[model samples]
Target: MVPPLVLDIDGTMTRPDDSVDPRFFDVLPQWDAPVVIATGKSFPYPVSLCHFMHIEQNVIAENGGVVLSGEQVTTNGDGEAARRVAEEYVAAGHDIGWGQTDLTNRWRETEIAVARDQPLGPLEELAAEHGLEVVDTGFAYHVKSPRIEKGLGLKSLAPLLDRTPEEFAAVGDSENDVSTFGVAGESYAVANADAKAQRAADVVLEESYSEGTLSVLEDLRERA
Candidate 1:
């Protein structure tokens, strides 16, 4: 059987331009098992992707701070605390960079996201002071509780899907994906993956971006 899949969105499923490849809209819905979108993005992003793709709403969002499986939702981390840290970061004179109407975090429930262009050192310092942690997803830096991570999200979601963490295949291309890679039975990092992700994955594909994700799915189909 083709195992269920957990995928990171930004650098993994997106094209070089950052838009999701249209091919996935055609493919993912037809997969034999569930496809869970795991990312550091806010809840609405992945949930919306599933909605538009005509797939089930299985997601691990906010870098594992929130999870959704059908009607079941589980939340971890402390969004309030993360928000405090971000406020302190701003007080320290750094811009969160998304501006006042920042939709990047508008619907987020368990963590705060900062634009990648901002300095990481200050964000890290502020987060540590608040007993929170900062994770770089290649797309943004997230402030969240240290205990929350995509691996934990997978563990929480697995039982709900009547599967084990080891029954899922994971694919990604950044530091934020490392935890999920460690928990998945099989993991793939796209050719453009950072060193951390490449080290964590079982295989590093030659193709980059969504092309690499397609390669992973194709290989899984053959194995099945």
Candidate 2:
């Protein structure tokens, strides 16, 4: 059986400007197996997208801080530590922003999602002080517990789908998704991915963004 596909959202399925490729919503539903959109996006965003596509699969959001399976949402990691770290960044004059609405905090659960414009070195240091980790998702940086990784989320969801980590593959374009790559037996990175991400991937596709995603899916179909 073909392994289920886990995907990163921002730079993997959308243009640099954040607009999704028209083909994604069209082709994803055509796949024969399940797809998990494992992204650094907060929980609701990907969940709504999946619903819009009429695809059913557990989603890993908040850089693996939260998992949504059907109507059930499970949160993992240290929320208190994450919030403390976010406060520190805000106090330091970093532009820390949350999800689009005020209620985003009600569900994000694990990591503090913030703008990626600031240098990660210092932010990482601050997160470490709080016993947290910083993950760069290309579009943003997440401060959360080490336990809140995409790999962990995938493992948590594996049993539900009756799939193993080796029976899974993931495509991503950022540092956060590296955790996903580690657990996924087969890992892919788009050409536009960061150097670190490319190094971690089993295959780095020549195409970028959604086109790269489509390429991997096509290869999977042929293999199946």
Candidate 3:
């Protein structure tokens, strides 16, 4: 049986132009399950990805701090916990990207058509400089506003479907993805995954980005 899929768009599926492999969409529709996007993107940014991928499913954003469906956003995070994490990042001295930024400004700055790319950082130094928590997956360092992780966000979603974290499969590459991988039954990363992420993955794609994701899809199909 095809299992539900959770994908990270930036490093996993696209380069920077919001372009994803058509084959991915082609095969994706065949899988009879929801595809949740767990990313740092906020507001209208992720909605565009859903349109591009032809997906009308649930999404987890802010590295799992925010959950969105249709036009509604939900919070499964602890209020004090979120506040404390944000305070820590600030105290550490890194520029934290949180909530919704001006989508137009983000696009103008990054040249990407989506608002998700607005969160920027040279993560390792940013973290080291400020003693902040940086989730490094290898490709880029996302400036996390709250220490709340994507894995936790995805885990909170279990109650919505009555499924366990082990039933889902997460695919990504980056420090932000580490927690997500831990939350999946069959976690995977691309060839470019950082050492920590790679170690946690059940499979590592030989190819990077879209190629790598498809490879894992093939393997999962076979195993299924």
Top of the candidates by lDDT: 1
Give the worst 10-residue stretch by lDDT in candidate 2: 97-106
Question: How many Å off is the CA of 27 in candidate 2?
Answer: 1.3
Give candidate 2's whole-model lDDT.
Answer: 0.82
Clashes of 3: 5
lDDT of 3 by residue, 108-222 (tens): 2111111233243434344445444544433323434345677887777755766777888889877678888887898888887677778888888789878888887787788
Model 3: how far is 57 from its true place, Å?
2.6
Task: Mark the regions of model 3 whose C-alpha exceeds 4 Å error after superposition.
Answer: 15-18, 69-72, 76-132, 136-141
Better structure of 2 and 3 per TM-score:
2
Clashing pairs in 3: 92-130, 135-175, 136-175, 137-174, 137-175
lDDT of each: 0.93, 0.82, 0.64
Candidate 2 residue 133 C-alpha distance from true site, Å:
1.7
Ranking by lDDT, best first? Answer: 1, 2, 3
lDDT of 2 by residue, 1-224 (tens): 56688988888989867888878888889877778999887788889888888899579988877887766677887588888887787688775664457354556767777676666777898899998887766677778888778888898887778878777889999888888899998999999999889999999999998889889988888898
